[model samples]
Target: MAGGVSNEEVGGKLWIMWSQGVLVSVVQSTNQFITVNMTVNNRCVCISFVYAKCLQMDRRELWNSLSSGIVDSQPWIVVGDFNVIRNDQERRGGRPRPFSAMEAFNKFIDTAGLSELRFEGNQFSWCNNQQGSARRWARLDRTLTSVECITMFPEAYMQYLPRTTSDHAPILIKLEAESVSYGYPAFKFHQTWVTHDSFLDCVANAWEDGIADHGMARLARKLKKLKQILQIWNREVFGNTGQNIQHLEDRLSRLEIKLQEGNNDEDEQDYLVAKSELDLWQDREEIRLQQQAKQTWLKK
Candidate 1:
């Protein structure tokens, strides 16, 4: 892809990394008034003008178009100048944070379920070459991914390095994936089971039974061991059981307290919100528990 293409340029380019024996397919091109789409892995990729006075591709429109026009289902990589900074921290010393822009971009990327390639080295790329107390700068380049591409090619990442000619540093990205899992003391209960009086009583009884015949010192030791075992059991059972009825109960209780906090329901809207959340929580717990049981089995 060339550096001076118009905001509306679009085309394809192949990257041959002989060292890794990989041929990366990148289609570099732009659409109607939209920045061009770059290619890699035979997918729609791009170099967008995010901060221009008049954006060639409005964030929403660009994403919607690309999303609807997905090419072959091969791994994809879209890397180039986004122009928009992701966070306030990107600037040397700017306002606290630009949340609106961050949120807008986030919604667009998340809508596409884009996965950011974690590039090592420098986090920022663009810089103002001047040094006195007056030089200005920005981090304008970035690499993005489609949810599908991340799964197909997990080894992908971006590398930001010094640019000899332009103020903006060049970006290098590698694509790949690695599998992993963590080992921890597994507990036997779910969050829903956490606030259960019966569950608490059962655990308390188990601890008491373990120390019934011991002195204070011995009792404490025995209780500690019992706690560990109980926690492990909980991890084994309810660890992955995502929120359920009990969680909804908490939400409802909190909402009710809020709505009734100063004597009044703001409106039917508040009531409906609370009611809907409550309903989902109520009917979801059993199904959640069953699914949790399956996860527990698989983990074990």
Candidate 2:
């Protein structure tokens, strides 16, 4: 661990990539590439290193290795500096990455699809290791993923951290808890009532034919009806949460008193039943909160 940085470099300064705990190296890298195995979240994730080389090496071998190296179980996030920039914004000094690199990157993206994790933050990862006017930068560092990983943690994102010690920026990524989904439908008490078939039918039946102002009047009337229905629905749904919460508090209080006395017959059975009831109430209360969140979404 290079001064507590937890570094494991392979293949000298020419390259470094870690997958799981296993390290791979190519010491005499005139080609300047290496591959390593690192595990994330108790799963094997592989990284294959490719460097800026003039040689016309086909990436098929490296790509094949990356896709095939691990046992077919864990989700994979293969990433690092490949000396490749995916788009024009990634290049500084207005010069773009080579077409070959972009082509290879698109190929990789096509292989992975929308299941890949979002690579957030400013695109540039490495700057020209020179000083003054000749200096430049490019997006090189990256984190990629397999389909399973994207689904497992949809909020996972990568961002470029400012460089301090090295010319290359550190890639910072955070794993999103499995539960959050960006567009998961929130309960919209308002919208739900507006969209209800019975309400819509009532609105439609109120309109008469052959009147020019009838259209606008009917539309306004329908909206008002929708709003009224939603208000009623919200009161009906969320209004009971207070009752459920109060019931839970009362049960917990009684149970705690029984446990404190430390004396009665049927204590074990009574405690278990009380505990189960408390848990059930808690679950119901949580559902109420989620329902309120849905209502908030609807209001928006």
Candidate 3:
């Protein structure tokens, strides 16, 4: 972690963590946010994690700090729970969000040259969790990146994972590069397949289809049948994971361009749907890579 809590009175703090291979150096830190330069594979990028104060007056300090401090040309990314929304559409079941608040937030993005990254999963990342009439939902958490950052990793996107114990859902920012293709080998079970909603159903169906034998031979036959079924399922459900991600990235880029020119509700909805689908596949990709690394480590 690169930052710490400065004030005991404040309810929230900011921190940034990375794996062993990545080099991280703190550039600046405050109660509101932590700025750092991260180097991976000899490429450096600046990232800031923010947890803004609930009050608009207090948040102005964070806005000013980001707008004035991050003046460099490096690929820059800003993410976290901002505690503010950019527009009316971002909130539901609450009193209409104040226009002044939205205006100020927009002003900061414009000043900083940051674009809200297209995202997948739930539309709202936070909720009051109240019942029907009293409930409130808002997109308080988000990922924003500079034009340079987008150019550097055009397939990058943000994913709002389903909320569990917390009122706020966890968000993931994926910075994807072009993938290298390796020829397919023997059948191997991917750990990520278990996370899919339909995986169990597919497994059960494949297992119960009725093999003729009654001993070790029967089990062997069933296993072979299941493998074949799983391979087909993987292709139909996920396709080529890397290629699918690239395709979605292209679609999102076109939608974003159309959105910037003007507001189109249809385009906005399509972008959200595509983002959600991309995130699902990206999550699977992350799990598969982690498992592969563990296997390689064990072999060595």
Extract clashing residue pairs from model 2.
19-37, 19-38, 20-37, 20-38, 20-39, 187-294
How do the residues 1-300 of candidate 3 rate in per-residue lDDT, one tens digit apiece?
A: 333323224444664667667788878777888888888899899988888998989888889988877757889999988999999888776688778988999999998899989988767788674533465678899999999999999999998765534678789888995588899888878998888899999999999998899999999999999999999999998778888877876676565445544557788689778878878777888999999889978997
The lowest-lDDT stretch of 10 consecutive residues in candidate 2 is: 1-10
Off by over 4 Å in 2: 1-60, 70-73, 112-116, 129-133, 177-300
- How do these models rank on lDDT, best leading? 3, 2, 1
TM-score of 3: 0.60
| Each prediction's TM-score versus the true structure | 0.42, 0.43, 0.60
Off by over 4 Å in 3: 1-12, 177-300
Q: List lDDT for all candidates, in order.
A: 0.53, 0.54, 0.81
Model 1, 99-127: lDDT tens digits are 76666666767665666778754455665
Q: How close is candidate 1 to the true structure, as a TM-score?
A: 0.42
Question: What is the alpha-carbon lDDT of model 1 when measured against the actual structure?
Answer: 0.53
Model 1 regions more than 4 Å off: 1-28, 31-60, 71-74, 94-98, 176-300
Per-residue lDDT, model 3, residue 113, is 90
Q: On residues 91-145, what C-alpha lDDT tens digit does candidate 2 reach at each position?
A: 6664655687677766766664423357754456675544334556666677777
Backbone collisions counted per model = 35, 6, 0
